[model samples]
Target: MPEATEDLARRGDRAFLAIGIAVALWLVATVIVLPIVMPDGPSQAVTDYLGALRDGDVDAAYDAAGAERHDADAYDTSFLRSEALSTDWRIQSVWTSDDLSPYDAKLTGGIEPEGHETQPGVRVVNAVISHGDATSRGQFYVQETGSRDFILNPFVYADAGATLGFVDLNGVTSPAHRADNGDKLTKKDSFALFPGFYRLYQHNDDLFRADPSTLMVLPGTDVDISTSLSLTDKGNKAAAKAVRAQLDTCEKSTQLAPSDCPFNPLDDGAADSVDAYDHEYRDVKDIKWKVLVAPKFDIEPRDGEGPGDFELVPRNYATIRLTAVGVDIYSDSDKAKRFSTVCPIDPEDLVLTVTASKSFTVSGPAHTYAGRACGRDH
Candidate 1:
């Protein structure tokens, strides 16, 4: 009886040991073999692409993204040489469409994998990538080869409502997406841009009449970027009116040089300095303001601020072009005069803060023009 009991115990122990070994083998197969044989999906593809970008291998990243030949090189150069330089970029999440029945709907031509028609597997992956403090999320549409290879299709796109115009953000040009019928620009209201900084007004003489505003295109979201030309028109009209109003003093006053006028910055304390001074050499004549071009506001972000934070800034040397002529002067003697007869006045960098209803407040001395260039008639 004792021997039979011992035999039974030994057989039970062997059975338990065999079960343990089998379980261990199963775990090993699941951990190693399954992963080795399993095919990579869109999530893995996004991970790989982001990994390439993080490593500063922009060429590889662009190839993975299937970007256009023209823009691919430019983006790569921009990323490495100037923008988006970071090594710690990491993928946070990936989202995809799971329905396999209609996988080829989003694929574009040329970049599609060979034999994709036969295999016909495609997926759109939206991935969030972070580097340091900046994070960007984008969509990538990828296609599978009939065999084992995966290729990226260039049709991956984002719809951000409308495009107002292009802005120069931190010296880099980016498009501002806005709503249609803004009536501010001559183009349609659809545009796209990679995440970056932008200025309100671009460098275009034709667009000098445009109001300036700061713009910022952030990552991971779609939004409308629009500004009112009405505000610009209002501010410009008000400012121009204000400046012109000041010049009107010159027209009303019989003095050769009006004390309230801002057309000239230099106060040389000459014979014309005295208001209503009698001049036997020349009588105070007609004064008129001729606006060669209407005023436009170019703005920049305030110090320690982004596109949303802004202040009026001048870019080109000339904002308002005009000829301010003071007629009626005897130029026989070269006597030093505080004001000139028949002088032309031009101003640059006319700074003003635009408010609601097209109103604006000027900065600096109220009586002094921000930029003044006055010369004797030649």
Candidate 2:
């Protein structure tokens, strides 16, 4: 054999020897060193707790941490909401330290908030809790009786109470669940919810339903859900019907005064003469009405009781527009067939203040939105 060949073989043998040593070291570390140095118990406890939560065994998870201040009802409702709204959480990392308690470990996971499905990585504190018994101290995400859970704090900003109960699209009411230990009614705002998806309706059939609207309750913020209600399709329909009823009274009027009809555009002098021409507002088209229901009870400074009794009366504003197909101005007084040009009654838009509650009742004199009459007026 050549000396060069022998030298190459010796080098290869040394390399193999180095690789073997490295493997041996790794084995030693995996079998002995890791066990001795890394505190797996804490990490394991965290895993067990997370598993319990994932399985909806909240009590088990709390028991694992020896949690004393466990409000099962509140926690259960909140957890259920979280689970329903959120996607599967993936464990990012699990770290343990000897300097910390044997049960102390830090865990990280990725989660996405409800509506934001495309994005992820909302980190929560999944740390191995070092409270209560030494054996269970390794448990993760546990809280004392009075203490708030870190995970829950981020999800629910405030316990909101609605003056009027809200019904979902399915007609499910807001106070969805009530538990002995965790009655949602006892909470402020009647709901402990963070801003997310909700469909709400007023109890009054006359009022509109808010369908699949996002209830914007910011985390760590308080809001009255009722203050921001909008008109539903049903509401718009009702409003249009009511306006047509009012128009019917106007259509059949002859005197053009309050006795005959509450709404008279001629009274405002916008029209030269409604009685002179035959005004037929059949199939009231392009009808637009939006009702904004606001907080009504006036906090008046009256001396009777301590800050006065709450008058159920609330005030709301209604914006309305009505357009007619034709307003016939005739040579003869008879409305039957004088044969005048078909004049379009442009949209008469009016904002009326109404004394409103569950239903909007026009408070003062009725408002009439009428376009131009035939004559140019002297």
**Cα lDDT computed for each candidate against the true fold:** 0.41, 0.34
**Candidate 1: regions farther than 4 A off:** 1-43, 66-68, 71-83, 100-122, 131-137, 145-349, 352-378
Worst 10 residues of 2 by lDDT: 301-310
Q: Give the range of the ten consecutive residues with the poorest summed lDDT in model 1.
A: 72-81
Query: Which candidate should be chosen as best, given lDDT against the real structure?
Result: 1
Query: lDDT by residue for model 2 over 35-131, one digit each (tens)?
Result: 4545244454445545554454645655553433333234223323333321123233344432321221112111223322222221223332211
TM-score of each: 0.38, 0.31
For model 2, the superposed segments whose C-alpha errors exceed 4 Å read 1-6, 22-50, 55-87, 90-158, 162-164, 167-173, 176-185, 188-378
